[model samples]
Every structure is written in C-alpha cells, then in structure tokens.
Target chain A: MELTAPDRHLIAALEGGLPLVARPYRELARGAGLDEAEVIDRLAAMVDGGLIKRLGVIVRHRELGYEANAMVVWDIADARVDDVGDRFGAFDFVTLCYRRPRRLPAWPYNLFCMIHGRQRQAVLARIDELGRVPGAAGAPREVLFSVRRFKQRGATRLGTAAAAEAAP
Target chain B: MTTFEKRLLDEFQRGFPLVERPFAAIADDLGVTEAEIIETLGRLRDEGMVSRVGAVFDPGAIGASTLAAMAVPPGRLDEVTALVNGFDEVNHNYEREHRINVWFVVTAPHRARLDAVIAEIGERTGLEVLDLPMQEAYHLDLGFPLQWN
Candidate 1:
C-alpha cells in the first residue's frame, strides 16, 4: 500500500508497539505530530484494512503462573475438518488456530490445536477429553511440548542473521 | 524512513529488551533522543502499521493443548464468530487466505475439555470438523521487515 506521509510516519512509530503509558494514544499523537484522534482513527482504519491483525496485550503464560503447555496436532478427516474446526475454535483456552499445508513425508496432520494450563497433568487430562470428542475420535494425534523457550515475542522483524545461522 | 525504526522492530520480534529505560537505550543506539524514539513509535502504532508490543509464548510451555481451525461459509461467519468469541480461552480469530477459512486457536485448561469442546462445536454447528494437527514446527516465525522504498 502506498502510504501517505502521515501513514508512513504512523506505521514507523507503531512498528514497535504502544509505549506503556498513562495515555498510550495521546503519547502516540504527540510523537507523530498528529492529534490523538487522527492517530486513533488511522490505527482503526489500518485494523479495518487487514493491515493490523490485532491490538491487545502480549502475555507470558509461564510468568502468569501457567506451567504446562503443548501443541496437539490432529489428523482429522478432510471431509469433516470444517465441522470439527469450528467446534474446536469456540473453546476459550485455545489462543491460536489455523490450517497450514501439510508437508508430505515430513508432515501428515492437518488439524492443529494448542492447550495451556497450570500443570502438565491438567493439560494432559484435557487432551484425553479431546480424544473422546465424537468428531475427534479415531483422529491421529500428537502433542509437542516446549522443553525450553529459546525465544518469543510479538510481531516484528529481527535477528535474521542469528536465526539464519541457527537454522540447519 | 530511518533504519532506527527497522532496528527497533527487529529487536522486538523475538523479545523486547527487559530494562528500566529500554526505549532510552534504543534511542541512544539510534542516535536519537528517548523522546524522539518514543514519539516515532507511537505514531507507527496509531497508524496501525504495527499491532502490539508484548510477549508471544509457546502454548505448550504453559500447558495449552488442542489447536484447530474451522471453515465457515461467508454468510455464516458473523454468527459463528459471535459463538467463538464467547469463550475466554479463545484469544482471537483470523480470516486467512485459504479454502478452510475462519481459522482460530483454542487453549484449554486441559486437553480433555479441549477435545470435548471441539466435539461440542461440531455437534452444535452441524459442520464436519477437519482436525489438522502439527507434526513438526519448521520455520514457524513470520517476522518480516517493513519495506520502505
């Protein structure tokens, strides 16, 4: 998108995210040399245009006292994916849900889900319950838990060299 | 456009520097004052070029299991979104570019309820749910630079 100068300025400013402040939007307006309303309106428009995915808090579950978490992949029947996906998406616990192309030979599961909780046992119990879901029954599944948090952050581009060097 | 903005965005992708005056440190490195950096970043946020500034963690690390997506017809999207948003577990949903549209992620206190919830949704919505799961996480991060020419 050919952004206007103001748009460019705003885009550049927001790329990092809102500064923790008493009035975040007001602070942003002062920085961008635009009024508070203009800053808010532009942001709202950007969100509406599908440029900004979401505006919300980014949290650390471990710090928040949630200890256990896992990625559950499901080999759901292609024909029934839509039906099962909706049911799964409605859950309050699942934070992210999406469909990605399954890499042949390396990947077989099409349906992926995430569960987080205070304890491993608690998360596992939820997995067992998922196994009993009529729509989820007979689906091949696997759970991959994070052994260590190498890195985590909101949307931004950084560490290209470090990441590329680490890639093998 | 300044390389300072790019650097800031890049630094934040993996994580923000946990410091007393992180912005000041960033400003010093970029040859700008802390006030200038803060002002610039605020403008970017107001413009909607950036979404948020915070942490992104691995669900598995925290005990969230069961992730999935459902495809809804264009007409029924609104009704379905309302239904999905009712759950506190559902952080957010997105409209993606694919055949199986209306992708959402669900985290649960445990896996059993996650499964049951999926089943319940299927039963309630009368839609055949495709349970696609992750086998291997290869190249998961999607952080890209803002190209300014």
Candidate 2:
C-alpha cells in the first residue's frame, strides 16, 4: 500500500510506542496531525494491508531469561525445503523460520530457524530432537550461537527520514 | 514480574486493541484497571522485558533487506565492526562463533540501493560478502509465546 502523507506521519509517530494511557490514539493523532478516528482507521488499514505484521507488546526474549539464542540452519533439498520449513514452523520452540539463498562454497545452509532458551545445553538438545524429523534426518545442519550483539534495533527505514522532515 | 505481567506479555503479543481506549480495553479483558496495565508496561519497558507496544511493520514492505556475513580476522574485528556499524543501512550486527564470524543485516528502500550498500561493504572490507536474502519464509506472525518460568 502506498502510504499517504498522513500515514507516514502516523507511522513516524508510532516509532517509539503508544503512550500508555486511556486514549493513546488521541496522542498519536495529535502527533500525526490527524484526528483520533482517522488514526485508528488508517492503522487498521495498515494491518489489513500486510504492512504491519503485528501490533502489540514486543517482548525481548533475552531480557526475559532466554539467554541462549541459536540460529540453527539446514541444507535441505530444494524439492522438500518448503515441506520441511512448514513442519519446522509448527514446532512450539521455533520462533522464526525462513528460507534464504545459499552462497555456494561458503554458506550451504538455507533453511533457518531461531530456537532461544535459557541454557545452551537445552537449546542444543532441542536442535538434536528437531534433526530427527522425517525429511530432516539426513540433512546437514549447524548451530550458530550468538557471541556478541553489537547492534540490535528495529528496522527504522520507513520513518527515519520522513520523521525528520516532518519534525519542526 | 508478576503473574499478571506474564499473562499480559504472553497474551497480548498481538491483537492489541485499535480502539480509542486500547489500554482500557486490555484492562477490561485482563481484569485489571487501565492505570495498572499502563504502569506495568512502563516498568517492563524499563527492564527491557518489552521492546515496545506498537506496530511491527513488515521489513520487506518497508524496504529490501538481507543477512550478510564476513569472516573478519580477530585483530580487526572491532575495527571492522565499527566501520560496518557506521552505515545506517545495517541494523543488526553480531559476532558468532564461526569462520563467517561477523554477520549483519542490511536494509535499503530499494533493491539497487541494497546491492550498492553490500558491494560497497565488500570493497571497503576487502572480504567476500556472503549475501543471503530471504527467498521464502514460514514464520509464525503471532510473535514468541513467552515461557515464563
């Protein structure tokens, strides 16, 4: 959906979060230069358009005792990748799953899923169990545990420039 | 965190009310006063337990993005990291225990812009840039269901 000037203004207003109050949209509408009703309607439209993936409390797993985060990747055969990926997504612990292009002679793993737990041992154990899935039995896989996170922030591209221009 | 806080975090990861009084709506469902819900969320944000209470836009809808990696030598890891982080396009940069140690995500408003950023990084770093863009995703959009123990 092509965003209108008001839509950009409203999204920019939402970059941080909704104010925890009785009438949050009123606050957003004020910032976006729209009225309360339009702000709510446009936001609902954005969600319906598949632009806003989710709208609610965004939890931080690591801060909530999920310290060990592992990106377990698999080199599944092209024909069965979609099938396997679907099955992987059904697992309760698989928070994220995606199929990406595999770089030849360097990175062979294409199917990726994130399994985060409080203990490294538990995460590894879960990965071992995941490897036992029918079509996943013979696939090559590797787990990359996060060593350090230099930067972890939301994708701010949509609003950064627009917000600045709208400011003042 | 209180039991109420856990329930709030778990149950409200999505389906936030788009009404004029959203917090009040959440309060009605959770059997808490609107003021209390607001206060707890504020505390959670301070503790980093909650990133925010807002819309998570589809990054693809916003721009083009890819996961890129580089095998930076140990001595130059920090230097290389500083350089990479300097780019506004790179949002997540991490060090993992592998030969392809330094991995980061790059996002740009257009495919050409995304490619130019990756190419420039390869040139400046003099390293093979392993660009991995998503071909398909089987993601569950409801967000993570917290296992609060």
Candidate 3:
C-alpha cells in the first residue's frame, strides 16, 4: 500500500517507538500534527493494511533468560518445503519460519526456523524432536547457534530523507 | 520477575489494544491506574527488557530486505564486521558458528537500492555475499512467551 504524507509522519514519529504513557496517540498526534482520533484511526488502518504487523511490546528474549537460540536450516525437497515449513511453523517454539533461496556449493539449506530455549540442551532436544515429527522426519538440517549479536534493531523505513527529518 | 512485570510481558506482547487511550484500556483490564501501567512499561523499556512498544512491520512490505551472510576469515572478523555494520541497511548482524560466520539483514526503500547496498558490501569487504531474500514466511510473529527457568 502507498504511504501518504501523514502515514509517513506517523511512521517517523513511531520510528523510535510508541511513548510509554497513557494516550500515546495524543503524543504521536502532536508530532504528526494530527488529532488523537486521527492518529488512532490511521494506526488501526495501517494494522489492517498489513503495513504494521502488530502493535505490541518487543520482548528481549536473551534478557528474559532464553539463552539458547539457534537458527535451524533444512534442505527439504523443493516440492515438500512449503508443506514442511507450514507444519514446522505451527510449533509453539518455532518463532520464525521462512523459505529463502539456497546458495548452492556453499549454502544448501533453504528452509529456516529460529528456536529459543533456556539452555543449549533444551534447544538441541527440541530440534531432535522436530526432526522426528511427521512432516519433517529425516529432513537434512543444520543448527547454527548464535555466538554473538553484533547489532539488532527495528527495520528502517520511509527512506533517508524522511528518516533525517524525523531525527531530533 | 514481579507479578506486574510478568503480567505486562505475558499480556502486552501481542494483541495490544489499538485505541486512543490504549494504556487506559489496559489499566482498566489489569486493575491498575493508567499512570502505573505507563511507568512499568517505561521501566521495562529503560531496563532493555523491551525493545519498543510499536508495530513490527513485515519485512519487504514497505522496504526491500534480504538476509546476507559472509565467510570472513577468523583473524579479520572484527574488521570485516565493522565494514558490514557501517551501512545503515545492515540492521540485524550476528556471528554464527559456521564457515559463513557473519550474517546480517539488509533493508532499503526499494529492491534496486537493496541490491546496490549488497553489492557495495561485497566490493568493500571483498567477500562473497550470500543474498537470501525471503521467498515466503510460514510464520512471522515476533512475539513469544518469555519462559524463565
């Protein structure tokens, strides 16, 4: 969906994040030069339009003691990847499941899922259980544990010009 | 965690109320004042327990993005990482235990710009960039339960 000027302003105001206060829209409205009702309506519309995935809290998993995190990649048959991905994504522990192109001769895994656990053993056991499941049984896979998080931030949007305008 | 923190993490991670006064609505449901709810969230954010209270946009929805990885030599890991992270598009960068040690996500306003950034990284780092754009997202929810042991 095409973002209007107001939508861009709203996104800019929200780039940092929603304020930790009652009537956040009121605060956002002041920045966007829109009324509180307009801010609420536009945000709701954005959510409905799929531009905004969800309006919620972003919990830091590591700080919460989910120390073991692994990005599991599978080499499922091209024909079966979709079915298998759907099944794997249904698991409560599978936080992210997606299909990406495989760079052959180097990277042969296309299907990827992220699993988080309290310990490495827990993550490994869950991966083992996942392999034994019906859809993904015997699927060739590899688990890459995250050794360090160099940088992690929310996605950048609107563009450099708009982003610069949003900066204080 | 205290009961308030626990409740905030559990209930507010997803399905947050989209209203003019969302905090007030949340306060009414949880039997707390709006000010108290706001204070708790502020503290949670300041403590780095929560990243933000906002929308998690779908990747490539408004901007183009791809997951790129590089096999940096062990010795030059730090230097190469600095080069990769120098770009604004490189948002999520991680060190994974594999031959392809460095993985990062690149995002731009358009597909062409995204490609240009990836090419620039390859030129600057002299590393073969493995650009794996998301073909399909089976499940994309970022919110998950925070289980404590």
Which stretches of candidate 1 lie above 4 Å from their native place? A1-12, A30-33, A46-54, A157-168, B1-149
Off by over 4 Å in 3: A161-168
Docking quality of model 2: it rates as medium
Summarize candidate 1's per-residue lDDT along A35-141 as a digit string, tens digits: 77777777666655545544433334544345565767777777776667666666656544555556454457777666767777878888888777767888888
RMSD of each: 18.2, 3.1, 2.8
Regions more than 4 Å wrong, model 2: A20-22, A159-168
Please list, in the order the candidates appear, how each scores on TM-score for chain B only. Answer: 0.74, 0.84, 0.89
Per-residue lDDT of candidate 3, residues A1-168 (tens digit): 777667777886786688887778899888777899989888888888887877888877777777788999999889988998898998999999999999888999989999988899989999998898665788789999988888876766655656635433
**What DockQ do you compute for every candidate structure?**
0.05, 0.63, 0.67
Cα displacement (Å) at residue A32, model 3: 3.5
Chain A only TM-scores, each candidate in turn: 0.76, 0.85, 0.87
Ten residues in sequence with the least summed lDDT for candidate 3 chain B: B140-149
* Interface root-mean-square deviation, each candidate: 15.2, 2.8, 2.4
Better of 1 and 3 by TM-score: 3
lDDT of each: 0.55, 0.84, 0.83
lDDT of 2 by residue, B7-119 (tens): 89998988899998888898999899999999999999988788789877775665578889999999989888998898888878988888889989887656776799889
Q: Write the per-residue lDDT of candidate 1 for residues B17-64, one digit (tens) a residue.
A: 334455676667778887876676666655544445643333343224
Best by DockQ: 3
